[model samples]
Target: MYSSGPKLYHVHNCDTRQILEDYFSGNQEMVFEEDFLKFPIRNCVTTFKLGHIKGDILIDLSISSMIHHLYAACEFFKHIIVLKVNDRCILELKRWVDTRTGAFHWGHVTKLHAEIDEKSYEFQDKEGKVRSAMQHVVKCNLEKENMTEPIDLPPADCIISAWLLDVICKDKDDYIKYLRKFLKLLKPGGHLILVGSLEVTYFKIHKEKFHCFTYDEKFVREVLVGEGFKIDNCNVSRRTVESDLIDHKGVIFIAAHKE
Candidate 1:
């Protein structure tokens, strides 16, 4: 079993609704909007639309616990498997998928995606596509050799890990180890889409603080190459909205293929 540590965000007790409201909602700055929403959606849609990134099954390993980024993938992939750190996240996601009461609204994200694609009339269609494409929401233990346990999942054709390793890993070694573990979940030559917060060491969820592994663009490129991944494309977007809420300098997006 994975043991909890001090200075960690307890996933079990994390308030998904509050998280969505505080960071993801429109009231706050556009940091999350640009880094998480616009950039990922643009790249995913562009690549997939151009017949570059094609896949059957896509695995999401993002800690954000939102399906905003998956909207683009739904257009290309038939099935999507979302791996969460805890049952709470899984349940929260399922609530939205099932359209249950008190489910967090993702219409803003959907609309933004629609605007970017110039398909304003198809935003509802995009939402439905993501909802229907999601096939599983399984719990993940990053510290373990097998991240997804009690469920032998098939190898994925593409993996999307957004701000997950930096938050969960304690050090560089742990990050590398976790990266290797994540690689095992993908088929050979499969695509790996990563979104990381650059030069960040900490972030807060409500009152609790969590640690982030400090890294730069050079480190990310070197690490990915060293771990047998061929860099396909990488881009970094500098943070425009600064706040004491988070210490990130920028957000980095990388698209790679296993070598």
Candidate 2:
């Protein structure tokens, strides 16, 4: 393990490839493959099955170049707008969308999703659907009044943010603040699907530890109700895979809609 004495870098300073390979890649180098990949992808597939979650437009604010979480969503939403805080992430996502050389392979994730949904025969169509639905990969600044400024994105039918809030939020207050911003981007009665770890303090990329907000199920439920959201479904899976790369107690998936 790399020395932990150095200050941890925030998401903005992260290397796109490093983060992808270390946490989300389909290789021996990946440590959180079970927790990060299978957990969220399966959670999202089940969450999107609710009839109300689908719509004309969906905005995704997931961490890194996470295309797995959107596999189930692409079938429901006519258009998908991906917002990234950094240009590197935007480019990385585009590389996959365009099927460019050296782009990260997501076939493992696609297969997992297919097997779960009982559509194993339609493996080739999964990636294509995501590419067709995902039309925009725009830059966003959470601190700005309009996160996707100058673009004026239409209010989405649903917003799915996976593990993004945990990484970017500095504290509980920051978490609520960002929640409000996310709530504003949704249309009336639009669904918000959130997936992340419960009581996670930090996640590592190789040797570097990145800040992750620590909170429990109680806090999440209270905050969502307090922020004018009607909780629809909440599922918590105990951390079965033990690893030193991350210190998360359990994984939580919540599907709530703006009230």
Clashing pairs in 2: none
Tell me the number of clashing residue pairs for each predicted model. Answer: 0, 0
Which residues of candidate 2, in runs, are more than 4 Å off? 1-12
Model 1 bad stretches (over 4 Å) = 1-6, 10-13, 28-31
Judged by lDDT against the true structure, how good is candidate 1? 0.80
Clash count in backbone of candidate 1: 0
Tens digit per residue, CA lDDT, model 1, 58-157: 9999875677778888888889999988777888899888989977788888888898888888976777888899968888887677877777889999
Alpha-carbon lDDT, every model: 0.80, 0.85
Q: What TM-score fits each model? A: 0.92, 0.94
Question: Which digits, one per residue and each the tens of the lDDT, describe model 2 over residues 1-259?
Answer: 1235323333336887777887788887666767788888787888777666888999999888888889999989999999998888989999999999989899888888898888999898889999999989999988888888887989999998888899888789999999888878899888888988899988876677778889999999999899888999998888877777788999888999878
Q: What is the lDDT of candidate 2?
A: 0.85
Best by TM-score: 2
What's the residue-level lDDT of 54 in candidate 2?
88
